[model samples]
Target: MKLKCVAIDDEPLALELVAKFISQTAFLELVSTFENAIEALSFLNQEEVHLVFLDIQMPDLSGMELARILDGKQGKFKPRIIFTTAYNHFAIEGYKVEALDYLLKPFSYEEFFKSATKAFQFFEEKENHLSANIASPSEYIFLKVEYQLIKILLKDIQVIEAYKDYVKVHLQGKTSPILSLTSLKNMEEMLPNDRFMRVHRSFIIGLDHIDAVVRNTVHIGDTVITVSENYKESFMDFLNKWIA
Candidate 1:
């Protein structure tokens, strides 16, 4: 699949060069080019761009500021960002917002291709993972943590806790939970409905692992999860099946 991309830079020459490089790449499609970050932001809000080649030192709205805006945006339209700047100091700040890659100024086509390739591989792997899950409901799932994809068995999951932009996957035999950069709502969609249930806004518990239920609370080993009012009725329905 061709990644729909856009290049944003204050320098006209830099923008043209990046656009030319994008044209040379087989997997990337240049959707549009922006001379400023503000116009790019406006375009991004109405477009379905998958990748962005951004310059860090643009006037008025710097690429760093624009990256922050995109990073903070909710939903699934978050396009991967690759910062292109002459200064090396912004690398840390660029990564702080989780940019896919960073491109230093006056970079060769080879360098641009390398960064583009990383973005391609990421999206490709992500699509394949999702496709595998949907094609066959499996006993295990792959969670991407940082640069690696960790395999986790569905049966081993005791609880899933939402922690800001990440989810804590509490396993059966593990002391520390595996933290992944994902939302609990996304986790709910990935997990099997028959084996897992969302007990609270911040939690999803394994049905088979529940030790006991007391009033609005559910005990799963040492973890006591409170069943929120929204999900209390559903949790009760599941409990009623085993009620004598």
Candidate 2:
């Protein structure tokens, strides 16, 4: 099924690029484009959209504000948001808003497609409830280790560390970590968001395995991973929900 989408950007070129990219993707259909956030929000109230291509900086209402407004609305349809911004500073803010992904300015079609594909996977999993239940204790993931496909239980994961093009999967009660040829971003997308979170650019720690949060550091076993400024807000948001 084609995902109904909309593009909102003050910049003409950016809006044009998003619209063009949506048109090229077989699974996405560009329903409309809005230069202002108010008009976009008005449209959202009247219609159901599956995905949004939003530019962060705008004249009247910023993309961040629009996302927060949508989040506040109690509804059955909240469009998956992909933020587009020239400044890399807003990345953490995007995460705090639970944005599907963020596209840095001057992004190529390849980058756009990668983020779009992540959105597709998310919606597909949501539509199929069984696949989306990664939080189940019986859930196991097959990872390529050496020449073998090793099945690892989701509940046994302690931490996942990214090393260049590869990732080291550390497990609880296990001395040896599984090494696989995969990007941390790709792995993060597969894991349940409520269970695993990216504290740093290189680290994705299991929430259950975390021993403590001292300032900006997350203590999982003896490893002290610093939660970078970019992700601290979202990580703290997660902590806030369970603190009481």
Candidate 3:
């Protein structure tokens, strides 16, 4: 899905550069550009935009103030914001408004792309109405990433690894795992109990995908996951069933 976005910067050159970068990116669609924050606010009130590339310091109304105003509103929908600023001091303030990322002035296209990718993921998750926990069961699960819904077959899943707040879903025949904004515990509850099992706090493996179990480790695909003591009793019970 293409994320509709607007660029707000007092500097004409910076605004143009961001517009060009947005145009070059396949998932972003530039809706408008504003030199004044007040005008941008007015336009936002009259239109629906999924994301905004906003400049922190602007005439009439500063981006910080504008962001505060938007955040104060109690609503189900709000645009994902990415702040562009010359000052690094406002980074913490940007977080208060829940900005997706901060792009310092003199940033290259590579930097812009990285921030834009994050914004895209946010919009994808928001639009899909996805939460940290799965609410239902199905044959396929939807993962929001890079402004797209990646459909992964449940049967194809081999392993799941917890990375901070995100989970990496390793699939059969795929070298790279799919990453999504969710916790390992949340995923453990969502997956079918008969098909999947949690062997460690940070790891969940498909029961059918386990190739071998050696000592305290379980092998699936090319990866090895340790069976923690907390879950070892149940894991051993299952392992004993197959050991004729």
Candidate 4:
């Protein structure tokens, strides 16, 4: 499928370059273009975009600020951002926010394709792996419940939250309460990495059930789970892969 995208740059030339590059790519669709972040935001709200070609310097709002604002929203629907900037100094900050890729100003189409290729590969690999995992799940697993063994479907679990000796099992049915258990490691071992990730020591979330993530908190509907610094890398990988 062609990746849906939008380009945002206050500089008309920069916007034109990105637009041209996107037009040249058969796998990418240039859904919209804007001279300002606000217009871009409005376009985004009205349509679904897989990726955004964003410039760091803009009059009303910087691309970094727009990324932060987008990340702050609810649900599992945050768009993957690719930052394009004149300054090389923002690379660190761009990556800090888990940007898909960074493009330097006056970059070649080859370089742009290189970054876009990485994003495409990352998403393709994730989808293939998730599809495989979902199709061939571990047949059954037992959750140790103090004195009894509770059997559950691997697909039915939304995620797990840990507290001291107890781990909460968020399941897939309507109005299902969290199942309490004492072993986080044991539960984690039973789950497949393609389907689950430990985003924090306190929370092991299902990749499928993650609705959205903002800042340090991950959202699954009305619930919010804190993301720890220690697990950020794994969490980001999961976010990219899972969201893909």
Q: Whose lDDT is greatest here?
A: 1
Q: Tens-digit lDDT track for model 3 on 1-244?
A: 9999999999999999999999999999999999999998898888888889999988889999999887665566677788989999998677666677899999999999999988777676654645533565467667644334577788999999998757899989988888876678868877888889999989999999999999999988678999999999999988998685
Q: Candidate 2's error at 189, in angstroms?
A: 23
Q: What does the lDDT come to for candidate 4?
A: 0.78
Alpha carbon lDDT at 244, candidate 3: 57
> How many clashing pairs per prediction, in order?
0, 0, 0, 4
The predicted structure with the larger TM-score, 3 or 4, is 4
lDDT (10s digit) by residue, model 2, range 1-244: 7899999999998899999999999999999999999999999989999999999899889999999887666766788789988999997677656688889999999999998888887777556544445454437676655423467788999999998668999999999888886789979988988899998999999999989989889998888999999999999899999796
Better of 1 and 2 by lDDT: 1
Model 2 segments beyond 4 Å from truth?
A: 130-244
Off by over 4 Å in 4: 138-244
List the candidates' TM-scores in order. 0.73, 0.57, 0.55, 0.57
Each candidate: what lDDT?
0.91, 0.86, 0.85, 0.78
Evaluate residue 66 in candidate 4 and report its C-alpha lDDT on the 0 to 100 scale.
91
- Model 4 agreement with the true structure over 1-244: per-residue lDDT tens digits: 6788899999999999999999998888998999999988888877888889999988887899998777665664677788999899998677545577889888999998987776676566545655666888554465544323455677777778776657888787757645554567867877888778887777787777878889888888778988889998877776676569
Residue 169 CA displacement from its true place in model 1, Å? 1.0
Comparing 1 with 4 on lDDT, the higher-scoring candidate is 1
**Candidates ranked by TM-score:** 1, 4, 2, 3
Q: In model 4, state the lDDT of residue 150.
A: 58
The residue pairs found clashing in candidate 4 are: 75-211, 75-212, 76-211, 76-212
Better of 1 and 2 by TM-score: 1
